[model samples]
Target chain A: MDTTQLLKGVLDLAVLAVVADEDGYGYDVVRRLRAAGIEEVGDASVYGTLRRLYSSGALTSYVVPSDEGPHRKYYGINAQGRAMLGAQRKDWDEFAGTMARLLGTEGGA
Target chain B: MSIVDDAIAQDVRTYAAQVRAALADLGPEHVDDLTDGLEANLADALADDRRAHRGTLADEFGAPADYAAELRAAAGLAPGSGGQRTGGAVDRALRQLVGSVRDIEGTTLARLRATRWFPGVEDLLVALRPAWWVLRGWALAHLLLQMVGAEQGAFWLPSSSGGWVLLLLAVVASAQWGRGEWRTGPRWGRVLRFASGVLALAAAILLLTLPQAHRDDVARAQGWGDRPVEDGVVVAGERAFNLFVYDADGRPVEGAQVFDQAGRPVTTEPYGGDRWRQQEYWPDGAGDPLFHVGVPGPNGETRWNVFPLHSVPGWAWADSGAPLDVTDEDVRGEVLAPSWPFAAAAAVVPWRTGPEATLPAPAGASTPGATPSAEAVPPSDAPPATDGSAVPEPEPAVP
Candidate 1:
C-alpha cells in the first residue's frame, strides 16, 4: 500500500497515542507526529482532527501561554479516547496475526 | 507589503470575525482568548507557508469560517447553519446598510481630496497663525462677494467650506503643536488631529461644490434651444453651431446631437435626462454602451461625442430634418431664435435681473477677484447673504 494511504489509516491511532502520553498543542502535535515517522500529517489537519476528537469527547483541551511565542492549546486523551485506542491496537494486532498465518511467513507477522 | 502578508492579514481578520460570531452564545469573555489564540496560530502557519513557497495559506488550511465552525463544534456550540434567522439576519442587514453608507461616504471623500483647491487652501492655512484667522478671512470674502453682485450678483455662501478650512487649519496646527509637546497630551491626540485634517478636507470640498451646484441649477433652467434648418450637411472638417435656449433652472436637460451630411443620424444617443446623469469614458473597448458621434479627426475618420469646449468652439443641437451641405461660414449666418421663456423668465431668475439692490461692500477694501490672502481682515460682523438678490458689490478697482 502507498505510504500516504497507510499514514491516513493510522493517523487517528497515532494522535490518540501521542496525547495518551502527554498533552500537546497544534504545532506541537505536528512535531510529535513527525518525530514518530508520520511526516504526511498536516498542521491544520492535525489541529482540526484534534478539535473534532475533543468535541466527540475522546479528548480534552486547555490553553497554556508560552514565553517564546503564542500560547499553546494543549489536548489530552480522556477515558473514551484511551478505550478507543486500546481497542484499535488489539484489532491491528489480530489482523496482523491473521495476515501472517495466511502468508505463512515469519516476517508478515 | 507582500501579497502573502496582505492575504494573511485579511484571513486573520476574517477568522477573527467568524470566531467571534460563532462564540456569541459563549459571551465575549469566554471566546476572546480562544479567538486570539486561533488568530496567532493562523498567522504563524501562514508565515511558515510563505517561507516554504506554498501558493496560498487558504488552500493549505480551509477557509477561516470553516475553521471557526470546527472550533465552535468542538466547544459544543450549535452548528452555525441552524441559527441563520435568529440574530444573524438582523446583524447582516445592519452591517450591509452601514457598509453601503460607508462606501458612499468614502468614495465622495476620496473625490473631494483629489481636487486642486483643497491642497491650495491647506498650503495657505499652514503658513498662518491662529488658524481661525485664515478661515474667518475666507468667510468674510465670501460674505462680501454675496453682498455685491460680483458672483453674477447672486449670494454664493457655502458655510460648509469655511467650516472645513478652519478644521483643516486647526488639525495642521495641532499636529505641529503636538510634535513640540508630545509629552503633555496622550498619543490619541495625534490620531484625532489626523482624522480632523481628513474631515476638514472633505468639508472644504462640500463647501466649494455646493455653491457651484446652485449655478448648475441656474444653467439648467436656461433650456437648450434648437434651430430648424431645411437641410444641413456637416462636412468632414470642423464646424461650429450655436443656439439660444432658456435655462430650465438647475434641472438636467436632454443633451442634443449632430447629424451627418446624408442625414444618417450622426450624433450618439442622447444622455443626461432622468434615466442617467453622468457617463464615464473608457479609452479601451471596456466602455459600456459605446457612444459615437461624427467628427473629422487626424486619423482619417473617427467618432467622438462631448468634445471639450476648448477643443470644439461651439455646441451642436440635434437636427431631425434632412442634412444640407453647409460650411462653417455658411452656418454662421443662421440666426437662432431664443426660447420665449428665456426672455420672460428674467423676473424669476436672479442672474437675469441686475445685481440685487442690497449689495454689501468688499470686506476691508481688498480688491474683488484678487483671491483673498491669509492676512485679510476677519469680516465677522457681515451678515450672511440670505436671498439671491444680496450680491456683494464688486470693488470698482478689481481688474
Candidate 2:
C-alpha cells in the first residue's frame, strides 16, 4: 500500500504536533515533517491542514515579514491544539501497539 | 530582487493565481481563507525546488487545479459546495448533468481500456481529434450559410468571399480552442461543453444530408428531373396522340407508316395525355361502345406508328383485365374512327416562277393569287372522311 494513503489519516495530528514543537511558517512546517521522515506529505495538504486548524481555533496564525519575498504566515499550536495532540498521540500509541500485536511484530507484545 | 529572483517571484505569483482561479467557485471568504498565503508558500517551495534541481512548479506540486482539489479535500470542504447557493435550480441541474456525463465517460473509458485492442482504438481516436475539430468547424460554417440561404452544395468550398473568411476564422478559433489556448471559468466551461455537444449533432446531420444535397444539385445541373416526361410527337407544345393524314383527293388514309427525315419510325403512342381515352366518339351509329382498342399488326404487336390507327369497339378480358382480343371475329365490330373536321379540303396549284413569293391558287382558278375564291373553300357536299364505306380492306400481312 502507498504510504501517502497511510499519511492522510494522521496528517492533521502530524501538522498539530509539528506546530506544537515550535512556531513555523507553511513551508517551515512542511520541511520539518519531511526531515522527520514523512517525506510523502504534500505541500498543499499541510497548508490546508494549517488553515483548517487555524479556522477551528486549535492553531493561531500571525504574519512575519521577510526581505527575501512576501510576508510569511506562521502557525503555532494553542492550548486546544496541544490537548488535541496529546489525545491523538495516546490514540496513535494504542493503535500502533494493536497493529504490532496483530502482525506478530511487537518485541514482547 | 535580482533578475533571476524576480523571474522566480513572477512564476510564484502566476502559479498562485492559477490555484486561486481553480478555487473560483468557492465563496470569497472561503477562497480567501484557502489562498491567503499561497504566493509566499509557493515562493519558498519553488526556491527549494530550484536548489534541489527538481522539476518545475507543476512537477513539484502537481497542476494547480489538482492542488486546489487536494486543498479543498484536506480542508474538509465538499466539492462544488460553495458555488451551489449562488446558482439557480436549472443551473444546478445542468451542472449535475454535466458531472454525471463526465463520470459516465470516465467509467466507459476505464472499461474500454481493459479490452485488448481498445488501447489502439483509443490512440487512433486521439490521432483523429484534430481532424474532427476541423470538420466540426466546417460544419458550423455550413450551418450558418444554410441558415442565410447562401450555401451552394459544396462541402469544402464556401460560395462567397465572406463565407471563406468566416470559415477560416472559425477553423482557426476551433483549432485554438481544441489546443486549450483560451482559459474559461467554470460556468463558461459548462456552456462550451454544451455548445460542442450541439455542434457534434449538427455535424452528424450535415453528414447525412450532404450526399442527398449533392445529388439534387447534379440533377438540377443536368436538367433531367422535376418535369413530367413527354413521349411521342409534340405539336405546338401539345402531344399529338394519333396522326390524321388526308390524301390529295381529301380521303382519309388508314395505317400510314410515318417516319422522320432520318427514317426513324415516328411512334404515336401518346403516353402524355389521358384526354383521348375520355373523349366520346360516334362510331357512325354502330351503337355506342364500352371502350376502344387499337388494331394489332400481323405479328400481334400493337402498331402505334400507324396513322389513323384502326380502332375497334372492345371490352375487357374477364380473367386478366386486358382489353378484349381484336383478332376474335365475334368481338370485332365497326371500326371507331374520330370524325374528320373537313369534308374535302381545297386543292392548291403550284406556281412556277415569282420574284416575290406568291400564294398558291385554287386548282380551278387560272391565276395564282394570294386571295381565296369561293372554289378555294372545302366542299361541304363531299363524302365524310369517317364514312363507313370509305374503310379500306386490310393490306397483305407484312410481317
Top of the candidates by lDDT: 2
Estimate TM-scores for all models.
Answer: 0.29, 0.39
Kept native contacts, as fractions per model, are 0.10, 0.42
Worst 10 residues of 2 chain B by lDDT: B373-382
Give lDDT tens digits, candidate 2, residues B284-306: 44464323345555455443555
Best by TM-score: 2
Interface DockQ of candidate 1: 0.05
What lDDT is reached at residue B256 by model 1? 25
Q: For model 1, what is the alpha-carbon lDDT of residue A22?
A: 77
lDDT of 1 at A39: 71
DockQ of 2: 0.16
Model 2 residue runs over 4 Å out of place are A1-109, B1-85, B111-121, B152-162, B212-229, B234-399
List model 1 lDDT by residue over B193-240, tens digit each: 555465456457546775687787666655443334322224454222
Docking class of 2: incorrect
DockQ of each: 0.05, 0.16
